[model samples]
Target: MALDFTTTQWITIGAGAIVSWLLLKWITSPSPKKFTVKVPEAADPKWTGKVLENPSIRDPSNPSTIVCYDPSTGYLIDTVPNPTVEEVKELYNRTAAAQVKWAKTTFEQRRTVLRSLLAFVLENQETICRVDCRDTGKTMIDASLGEIITTCAKLRWTIDNGESVLADDYRAPGLMMMYKHSKVVYQPLGVVSALVSWNYPFHNAIGPVISALMSGNGIIVKCSEYVAWSSKYYEQIIKTCLSVNGFDPDLVQFVPGFADVGEAVVQSGVNHVTFIGSPAVGKLVQRNASDYLVPCVLELGGKDCAILLKDSDLVQAIPVLMRGVFQNCGQNCIGIERIIVAAEIYEKVVEEMNTRIGKLRQGSILAEGEGVDCGAMTMGNQFEKLEALVQDAVSHGARLLRGGKRYHHPKHPSGQYFEPTLLADVTPEMDIANIEAFAPIMVIMKHQGPEDAVRIANLCPFGLGSSVFSADKKLAEKMCMQLKTGMANVNDFAVNYLCQGLPFGGVGISGYGRFSGKEGLRGLCVPKAFTTDRIPGVKTPIPPILDYPVQSAKKGWSFVSALNNLVYNPEVPAKVGACVDLAKANI
Candidate 1:
């Protein structure tokens, strides 16, 4: 057989082949080179050890400035301006105005902005981690895992999948409306607001910004006053990224203040709000957003649990358990606050964990070498509450295996440090078992069986993330299904969050709505449903029998009933009778 092609057709085929090859290479290429950042032997020489015990305190002289300092080394970081409520409103207005123009930009333009941010993060991963460590009192390793890596994953996922997620979705019009076309067009929702906590300052600040800009909306981030120092630096990074990408930097804004500022942001007339904080504060945000009838997504506190069955692999599970409890100085919302161990291995697990906890060296990460296993807590005010909870638990027959109180670090007495704690024989009746002890305390409860384990795990009001470990895959899966949480893992812990495609959120006191993944990106936009004629000349016209004049009301009713039956009836006889009746009614 012989085939011939025109020159134009050959050129088109060649161009398509080249494009396909280039796209394949782009998708399969390895990620940017990951640099190994070394922990500094000492704090930054610029740190003057001038501690501001309360960063939220307004400078009496200036009244408009917040005293920001390092929680770890007690070093004076810097002072950030505390914007007034009126300033917050004005900031939101400017952001909304810029969003009007941004919403008109193409997906490619948005991708460029995200790519610039991704590149900035990759190039300055060390600097980002250092800033986060300074502000949050977390170790460099913790910052790498919680701040740098998570932010990069989110940026990468959004850049690759955001356009498709926001694209118009064509839907079937059904048989009766076959001549019509229907679709859901995702459109921008103007300005959105996020009130983020200080734990993962960099990640929290950048996360909402990425989603909002990708969905063609502006964002105003209300950062915690505790991390105001780092928030100022992050705000500069975002603005610089936007400006260099030829975007209006006003499209994104960061407001750093106390409760009044957060309340102002929620009621700032933004189209939507996302809040990440305590359950107490989340309720306030919801109430304030209700004033404008604006929708909100709240990611609140959690008492995440890990259940270890008798047959579970201790070698593999112990490391995961350690990381899950001690990560981010146990300030993680999803960190395992409770551990349910089978009675058979309960004592062994306690012994193993206690030995590990004894060796954990805690100090200010910024003060010395990388030998420290855990860093200082972000806030010292919570120490009293945490101690009270532990003491209450001890009073209730819980065995305090090790570290029952706060530890004053020998090297840095000013720093907030809590000993890595291991408390065994924890019962549901104990206050510590039911409350969200967001600290380094590891509470272990004995479970006779899977049912008892689940009961203990679900005792807390929070229903966030959970983990079930067992050698039997079937049993593990079954128990995981029974756990009362938004997300669960079998033989794993917190791996769901590492996979960026999965939505992250919870139920009950943990709060409602989802963030991350496709659900999150779409949630930021309005799903506008629209329909039009499928063919150029095809149209729907009002029938004479059912016209507004209603010359024959009885006939109009009969006509509608027959039409519905003809389209919906499954039996041939019924459809035939309906057709006949429709004809008679029309006449």
Candidate 2:
């Protein structure tokens, strides 16, 4: 267009054009291309769902029809279906069938398979750690030390020493039975049902199986439903090893489910049962086993206590005790839930603990990364329990030293995260004092002396594990001997359970029996007594003195009297004369 304008008018026209161009660019832009890095998908999208869904159903098109969630984000990880009642029945059948053949195999053959499993675990440790960390909401360090490596070490120990442990034990025949040879032989209990806990899923799942298989019993591991994903992969590894070693894969199978599935297995005519979980549930398992008179081992939860004596060095004790308290986020059954400190160091220890707890980092637990100290709670109810415990204690006059509530991260808001809570002035009457916190909560109680510390530690019904931290070795040993725990750690804590050679278990409400050592290996088998007459042609002989009839009247009475005198008389010369009389009567 042929138009004339002043210089100011031209400038106004240029500014309007610039503004319009900028507006147009903003409208038509690609919105800064929202930066996102390409990464491998963690789990199959189709299999993710609520845990309560019917996991028995399988979709042919999908990798898994069952679903489980990631605790860190409350998002679906993947579903691996728990067994239905029918499936559990099938598992029992398979286990029973496998037991027949497994029991027939020699101990060497059984040891071979166990060694193979250990080798597989050692070889696939990285994969195991990753799956464990993902499924349990624990750090890789925990999965590595607590689950994979620890289990492998146990398996190695089992393979090396299980043979002699299960061998026939010979007994010395008493003087009365000098003419007979006595021996005790171990026989396999047919099918063993192992109800594994979720906290240390890998270790708990495989531990009983090791003993059961080593003793020639077929085992079916019923995995916790909350940690089905880890179980699935673990089952795969075990089955693969079994198949490769030419043993029946059913010798050790995993049936995943909730409490119903575990109960079903217990009620399914299994020869023996082993359960590792809470005391309430352990009692249920015992009751269930009682119906059939099937012997069961219950490794229940512990309110493990740590005692810091007046002679304890704070520098040496604090880190070890904190690790004992907060390791696995205090989800460990043997973790230090209660700390009884001497009055001399109660305030100092509590103050230092609170300060140390504050320095702990809480966030999304990563499988591969470092720097995360505390992670999300694996189960939803655990978060609630932690909150309730703290509230209950605080309401009951307990002083909250640090972290009195739940924690939330901006990026991982859905996760069940809690702070490392510390409480002081906790009394025996308080609910938190008696209960297993099973979280990163430390309860501190002051004691008058070493005896008071022992008294307080022994007050709990649970006797799984207790510890004494002291600079005095002799005094600590004395305290350890006095503690009624199944196993006691002196100076350090909780690591005593990791010793493969030591027997680990509890007494009273903490449950009964032992595991992880010679007793455990032998416990998996039934004892059979064998006796044979050492004298030739003396078969089917019973002591004539024990016969019902009082034959030879006076002579028989005199012989019996003389035998009693020989065995139970107080004076030595009279006993000698009675022995001579007894021999003369026999002659």
Candidate 3:
């Protein structure tokens, strides 16, 4: 028998259809976007009709795309002088030639010249700051003092600390009448290629260069096209300043190049390559390294998480979370991209997050210290990509609790700025939270409990940095252990690892080799050993057994020394006292 639909069942089906249609309409509705216009110069404004007008592109064969900007109008300035491939090659050859002499110079000689260069950098802070602001769209306040100042500090620190890594370690004279010996020391490699990013141009370039150079290696630095001029010419200015101070200008050379040049620079049979960029390009560098079998340090992308559980202080967690996501317009590799909130505090956290996001005041790039909340993205295409991600998430059922739109001033239509935006109801299932949005947007995800938060946080393919906000010490400890990330902050996001003298590297898709801190410094070189010998009847303790038969009279002393040293220094002995001291300690 066939079943027939009842009147109540038919009415229920009709109601379901109406509800589904209404839901579809709500999802497709156009969310309104607002903007505030900003004009730089009303007195006199000049528009350059060329995107490649940066003077650096002047060379025909070794052409470059200029990154010039008019500060008054936030307009892409004009063409300047681009360092051609020829210029890049010339710089490479110079560095290659000078590296031979530089590597051979005594540690003190290198140290002296490095110090002089640091001094030169200090003297040119003003000009460097202006160039940084114009080239990359970062305010001078951030670039010069923030980026350059930190770069200078790292330069001096790397120079000073580098010696310790290369310091010649000697093994004490061993037992065969000082005839046998072993040695350990730090040896320098040939030229190294440093491929840097634009976010923190100066610091990004200086850190790797300092480490590689201090290890007695020649280096070629490839800057992001966004700020290639800044990175390439910095060394020249320092060299010019140092010439008067009489530092060896030849020891360091900076060259500007494109992606092709970057590829060529890394593939040119260099000793090592240290790269800080996206994983795709990093992989390219790593593959390039395979040809020559050279080692590389690749710092890539990260989808870091920030967890806010019950009882967490909204005041503290709120600002830190915003900073973790919004710093440098949310372009940081280790910046917070995911916010996992515990159900108990989910609504409260969302309310507070919306308040903070709402307070953001978008403004021109030149707003040095303006109360303005954020600046334009340095990379224009990045803005469009970020917009698409937000729209996709909205279309896929994620509801925007706040800031789901972009604002533009009609007058300055060409301005690259985007509004500070936040989205709530983001689920792990949504691509919005899974992939990285390298822009000024933040996403908040809800969780049933701490277990769910941890599960979702660890779900991403990335494992760069993570944070847990809990008054409970045990929970914080446990979460840090469970998460598969390189660095985790208990009450904070990342800002913790910056220049704190700690090693920082990602675990999963982040990258391969480590840099910064002990592991980083050590990664720049290989360890070597040194050995020496001492004679028989040398009161070598005779294994603390005077009656023991000798393997060989000549070899007897070595055997005894090895046995005695085992009781004392498991390595090699520096002094009788050291041996005796180590023996008692180890024994």
The best candidate in terms of lDDT: 1
C-alpha lDDT of residue 314 in model 1:
99
> What stretches of model 1 exceed 4 Å from their correct place?
1-24, 27-46, 51-64
Candidate 3 per-residue lDDT, tens place, 100-135, comes to 876787766566556655765676565666556555
Instruction: Give residue 26's lDDT in candidate 3 (0 to 100).
Output: 59
Q: lDDT score, residue 96, model 3?
A: 80
Order of candidate numbers by TM-score, starting with the best: 1, 2, 3
RMSD of 1: 5.7
Q: Candidate 1, residues 1-587: lDDT per residue as tens digits?
A: 88798999999999999999999988975443222233332235344556555443457888777777777666766777888989999998999889999999999899888888888888888788877888778999999999888888999899889999989999999889999999999999999989999889999999999999999999999999888878877898888888877889999999989889998898888899999999998999999899889899999978998999999999999999999999987999999999999999999999999999999988766667578889888877788898899899888889888886888776676777888898998898888877787889999999999998988887788999999999999998998888889889988888888777889999889999999999999999999999988999879989988787889989999999999999999999999999999999988
Candidate 2 local lDDT, 133-223, one digit each (tens) = 6677777666676888679778878877888888888899876677889999999988888898888878888888888888999888889
Give the Cα error of residue 407 in candidate 2, in Å: 1.4
Provide the lDDT at 311 for model 1: 97
Error of 3 at 363 (Å): 2.6
Q: How many steric clashes does model 3 contain?
A: 33
Worst 10 residues of 3 by lDDT: 34-43
Candidate 2, which segments miss by more than 4 Å at Cα?
A: 1-66, 535-551, 564-572, 583-587
lDDT of 3: 0.68
Error of 3 at 61 (Å): 13
The lDDT per prediction is 0.87, 0.79, 0.68
What's the ranking of the predictions by lDDT, best on top? 1, 2, 3
